[model samples]
Target: MSKNRFFACIRSSFFSRLLMGVVAAAITGTACAAGEAWPKEINLGYQKYGPLIILKSTGELEKRLKEHGVTVNWAEFQFGPPMLEALNAGSLDFAVTGETPPVAAQAAKGSPLVYVASEPASPQGEGIVVKADSELKTIADLKGKKVAVAKGSNAHFFLIQALAKAGLTLDDISVAYLAPADARAALERGDVAAWSIWDYFYAAAEIQLGVRALANGEGIVNNYAFYTSRRDFVEQYPALIDVVLDEVRKTDQWVKNNPVEASEKLAAHVSIDAKILEKALRRSNYGPEPLKPEVTAAQQKIADTLLAIKLLPYQINVQDAVWQPKGK
Candidate 1:
C-alpha cells in the first residue's frame, strides 16, 4: 500500500474512537505544565515493528508532542537488547522491547529502568526455525547441534525454554550468539542447525529463506512486548510518558483496523516484502496496556526462569522496576 492509502485508511470510525479515547485518557494532567521545563527533545528507540513503524511513518508522535515544544527523535535498532542498552545509557528516554531484555537489563549493574506499559501477548510472533531439509525435526534433536540466536534477546529466552521443555539444556547444544542478520546467514549456509528469532525477520526467513518453524512461543513463552523508560526520566516527566503511551494506544487500534496497509507501511520502513510483513503483523497484538499485577507476575516469572538457568547474576524482584503512576 502507498503512503496515501495508509493515511486514507485512518479516516474511519475505529480511528475516530481511538483518538477520542486517547484524548480522554490524556486530558487529566498528561501534558507538560506551562512553565515546567519540558525536555527540548525526547528520544524514542524502536525496532521495525507495527506500532513504532506506523507511528514513525505517519509522523504522528512528532505532531502530537509539537504543541508542547518537544521534538521527537527516532533511532532504529536491530533488536531489543541494544535498544534497552541505549535506554539505560540515557541516549533514549523511551523504548519498546520483548520480555527478556528487561530481565537482562535489570540483571546488569548500573542499568536502572522501569516498565511503564506493555503490548499484549504475541505468542506467534517468534519461534525456532530450521532449513526444510534439516534433520532437526524436534527440540530434542537440537542436542549436539549448532543453534543461532541473538544473545540477551527475547529469542534467547525462547531457545532456553524450548531446550528445557525438551529435557535438554544449553550445554546440550553448540550455541552460536549472532544477531538476526548473521544468524540468518549462518542458517542459510548450513553453519547452524537451527535459528531462534522473532518477526519480521522470522517471517522473512520462512518466506524467503525456505525455513520451517519447528516450534513457536505458543504454550512456551508469553512473548509480551514491553515499553520501558529510564527510571529518572519517568520520574521527571510522567506526563510525557503518559502522552507517549496515549499515542501508542491510538496507533495500536489504527494498525488492527488496517493490517494490510499497516503491513505495507512497515514493509517500506524495514525494506521487507509486504507479504512477509503481513504474515507477522496479522498474528501480533498491539496496544499499551498498564503494568498491572498480572503483567508484573508474568514478568516476574520470566525473571525467575532466567535466574534458574543462571543467566542472571542474582535474583531480582521484577516489581522493583515497575512504574507506579500517581494516585494508582
Candidate 2:
C-alpha cells in the first residue's frame, strides 16, 4: 500500500474512536443527572397523628407500592424533629411531619430534604394549657413563668406566636424544653406554669388532667403538616410520590367523612380515650394539598421568625427545598 493511504487509514480510525468516547460520556452524564435507581423498599416515618396512621392501618400504602415491587417499612416517631432526623440520615426515604420541622431540617447544612405535599392548617389541633385554677388566665401572664415546649416542634412555634400576640417575646418567659410526655408530668406536678402541646396529648390533658387552655393556636399559628422525602428519592421516583400522596389524600377524605369511626380507630391504636380522640378529631380538618406558593410563604415566615429569635443558625429559603415534579 502507498504511504499516504496508510497514514490516512490510521487517522480515520483515531477520529472514529474519539467520537464514540464523546457519545458514551454524554449518555453517562445524562443518566447521573436523571438520578439514582429505585430501591426494593422505602421507609416511611409517621407520628401517631394524621392520615399516615390511617394509611398504615389499612395497608393501602403497602398495596400500592407492592404493585411496583417496592416493599414498605414503617417507623413511628413521637414528634416531627426526630422523624426529620431519620429522614436526614437516609434511614427514612419518605415521612410526614409538622411544617416547622421541614424548615428546621432545611436550615441545617447538607440536608437533602424536600417538601412534596402538605395538610391544611388545623390550628385548633394544638395549644398551650394551664391548670384549670392557675392564675395565669392570659398569654401575657406567662411572663417570667416557666413554660414547657418541645424545642423544635410545631408547639414551639405556637408558643412563640401566642407570646408575641400577647406582647411577650420568648425572652419574656423562662423556657423549659421538654417533650410532651415530660412536659405533661411537669404540668401535673406544678413544676411548670403551662405546657404547649398537640393532640391527643393536649386533649387528654384537657379532659383527664383538667388543664384549661391558656391560649390555643386559633389565630396565632397555622399548624400545617408536611410530607417530605430525600431529594434523590423524589427525583428518581416522582410517580411513586404521586401515588403516595393520592393514597393519603384518599385517607384524609375518609376521615373527613367518618369522623366518629376514624377517632375510634385511632384511639384503639394509640390507646387514648375515645372521647378525647373525638374532641381532637372534631376540630381537625383532614385534607392534603400540594406545595403551593402561599404554603411556602407561610413556611418562610416561620423560618424567619426563628432566625429573628436566633434559634436558627442561618437563613433558609423554603422554596429552595420544595420539590418540583418532572415537567411541572
Backbone atom clashes (below 3 Å) for every candidate: 0, 0
RMSD of 2: 3.9
TM-score of 2: 0.89
Alpha-carbon lDDT, every model? 0.88, 0.88
TM-score for every candidate vs. truth?
0.88, 0.89
Q: Taking the tens digit of each residue's C-alpha lDDT, what string does model 1 give over 7-81?
A: 787777678999999897666444533223467899999887668767888888898899989999999999998
- Judging by TM-score against the true structure, name the best candidate: 2
**Sliding window of 10 residues with minimal summed lDDT for model 2:** 30-39
Residue-wise C-alpha lDDT for candidate 2, range 151-197, written one tens digit per residue: 89999999999999999999899999998899999999999999999
